[model samples]
Target: MNDADKKRLLREMIFYRRFEDRTFEAYMERKIGGFLHLYSGQEAVATGVLEKAVVGQGNKNDYVITGYRDHVHALKTGAPAKEVMAELYGKETGSSRGRGGSMHIFDPTQNFMGGYALVGQPFPLAAGLAMGCKHKKTNQIAICFLGDGANNQGTFHETMNMAKIWNLPVLFVCENNGYAIGTHIDRSTAVRDQYKRVAAYDMEASQHDGMDIDIVMEAAEKAIDFVRSGKGPYFLEFMTYRFRGHSMSDAKSYRTREEELEWEKRDPINIYSKRLIDAGLITQDDIKAMEREIDENMENEIIKFAEESPEPRVEDLTKYVLDDNPDPRWIGPLQK
Candidate 1:
């Protein structure tokens, strides 16, 4: 990457961090309800990984599916920030038409399939997407983002075996943030180093530092290249840490303050920005200006868009439920 590209990525990561930070505030103020997972410290994983996938195969349209910490993934896939924020507010103009919030940010135009709320749900679905791309000979691939805790789900193993047998064009990227909703990987899962978990299925896998965007980009390029070659599936485990609790509701009581601060030292946004600054590509004032711009955009535009957007109507409660079929059985009869 050129000096300019590095600087651009640094700002983008900062924007993502601030975006999530703003969402945290919104959730606290009761604007965003339901399961709110912030992708604060793990910005590099999605930003770096998808950076290659977007341009891969001549931008032939790759598919993305991840677990509920998906705001960044959706944004990186070209979903507008306003639409995402509106979804969090459950507004009429939100993505998924205000039906699926936070955990289910779906933008099919960009081929970001959706974020699944179920543990390991995206696993098999990702393989299915890859299978379709292979069958259609579109040269497209499916990128599945998963959490470390999700590796224990049965779907992980099943999909890994199936992807290898069929040689599906899918790349599974695991964000090992050391915990499964307060349960550390060591307590509940075997093989703390998540990359090795795929070895049982004889799939290609590796681990890296998710705190560094450039490192993730380099690793992702190699992995995407191998998968796009139709050699089957590749699993990448990025050792990362989440600055916030698993969800908004989580107090993070399971971990100590010392451990949290230790991981905070390796914050991805700080690491990347520091590198750019040290390289003489950017200055602290430039970073502050970028932050100011982001703050203004979020406050004046993104948040305003969501707050001003109308909520989904009660009469149309069942509207997007099932192809506009209006199934009273599902939502239990709309208002009389």
Candidate 2:
């Protein structure tokens, strides 16, 4: 990539980090409604994988499906910042028209299938999409993302086996963020190494240092290449950690403050920024300017959409209930 392209990728990653920080603040202030999952510590994994996937594809034809801890992915996949914020705010102009809220932001236009709230639902859904693409002779690959917790689901096993057997175009990525809600990875699985989980299905899976953007980028490129070259389904497990609690209401007693601070030292943004500066790819002033610019842009959009966007009318509740027959005005005009 050229300097301009590199800078754009860096800036995009910064925007996701800063936007997520603001979303956390919004959750605390009671602006964002429902469950809020923060992706602060695992920025590099999403940022890095997305850069190559979107860049290499040349556009948004490729698909992405992931679990509820998905705001960052949604934003990076081309969903508008204001619309994402509004979706959290439960406004009508949201990506799902205020229906899905924070957990289920879907933008088919951007090829983002669904920000599925159910822990393991998207695994099979993603495989099915990949199968469809294969049958249709489309070159587009479906990047299915899941958490460590979701990997243990029955659907995950079935999907992996079937994807490999049928030779579907799918990249299975697990963001192993150490803990499943309040439970640690050790307690959840006998084998804490998530990449090894795919061994049963005879699929290609590997672990990578997800805190470093370059490391993740290299691994992700190989995974994508494998799938595109007719390797069927590939699995990638990213060893990462989340800075915030499981949700806005989490008491967070499962993890210690010292542990949190320790992970903070490996903060993806800080690590990447230092690497860029040390390598002379970017300067300290450049980083500062980038942050400021992203912050300003996000703030402006947050206010613009949240305050200006209207909520869907309660009388129109029955509209868009089914895929086959969508009712634009199901409830009709409200009676006086």
Candidate 3:
């Protein structure tokens, strides 16, 4: 990558870090509601992969979907920070018009379908989207992001089988953060190696260090290339970590502080910043100025946008509950 590309990647990683940091603070201060999941430690995985997949590197028509830890993905997909923050705040100006809250951020224009709150739900949805692209004869592919825990779901296995049999254009990315809520992967899953599980379907699968952006970008480019070439589906497992608790209400008694600190030492932002400095792509002063600008933008602009945004009215509570135009045969008894 060129110096400009490196700088852009750095800026994006830093923006996500700051955005997630500020979001946690906002949640604590009661500025945001719903079950909040901060993508603090896993920034590099999303940044490296999405930056290469969506931004300039890959096809613009590609679809991106993920589980509830979706703020970073939404931002990387070109969603405005102010509107995303407003969504978390449950305001009328949110991406989902304040109804979906933090879990269900959807913007079809940007090709970010929606963040599924249910574990492993995106697996089938992604396959279905890929089928649409295949039927339409479009070069578009669907990138499905899920947690390691979700891999154990029956839907995940079913989708994998379908993708392999039908040769769907989908990339299944498992963000293996070591733990699924309070239960560790060992306790919950029979097979710890997620990538190995794909061998049964004869699909291409590999694992990479999620903390390194360059590594992620490389893997993502290869995976995307293969899928787009109509070689069927591919699976990638990112060995990443999540610094924060599963949710805002997590007591965090499951993991040790020492383990957390050890992972903190390998923080993606710090690692990438150091690489940029050592490679002469960026200076300490440059990084400081970039951080300062991001802080100002978040505090002065984005936060205010969410704060001043109007709340959704009670009368319109059921507005998006059902379809705007329903088929007569499909209409339910309640509607009749």
User: Highest lDDT, which number?
Assistant: 1
Clashing pairs for predicted structure model 1, backbone only? none
Q: Write the per-residue lDDT of candidate 3 for residues 172-259, one digit (tens) a residue.
A: 9899999988899999998888999999999999999999999999999999999999999999989999989998899889999999
Models ranked on lDDT: 1, 3, 2
Q: How many clashing pairs per prediction, in order?
A: 0, 0, 0
Consecutive 10-residue window with the lowest summed lDDT within model 2? 52-61
Q: Against the true structure, what is every candidate's RMSD? A: 4.3, 4.1, 2.6
- Per-residue alpha-carbon lDDT of model 2 for 1-336, expressed as tens digits? 566766776787788778778888887788887888877788888878877786223244678889998888887777777888888888999988899988998887788888888888999999988888888787778898888999878998888899989988999889999888899989988889998989999999999998898899999999999997787899999999988888888989998899999889998888877877777889989988989988877777675677689998999798887654546477446556
Ordered list by TM-score, greatest first = 3, 1, 2
lDDT-best of 2 and 3? 3
Question: How do all models score by TM-score?
Answer: 0.94, 0.93, 0.95
TM-score winner between candidates 1 and 2: 1
Cα lDDT of model 2 overall? 0.84
Model 1, range 1-336, lDDT digits (tens) per residue?
A: 888878878878988999999998998899999999999889999999998886322236699999999999988888888999999999988878789999999988778889989978999999999999999998899999989988999999999999999999999999999999889989999779988888999999999999999899999999999999989899999999999999988999999999989999999888888888898888999999999998999999999999999998999976654666546787676667
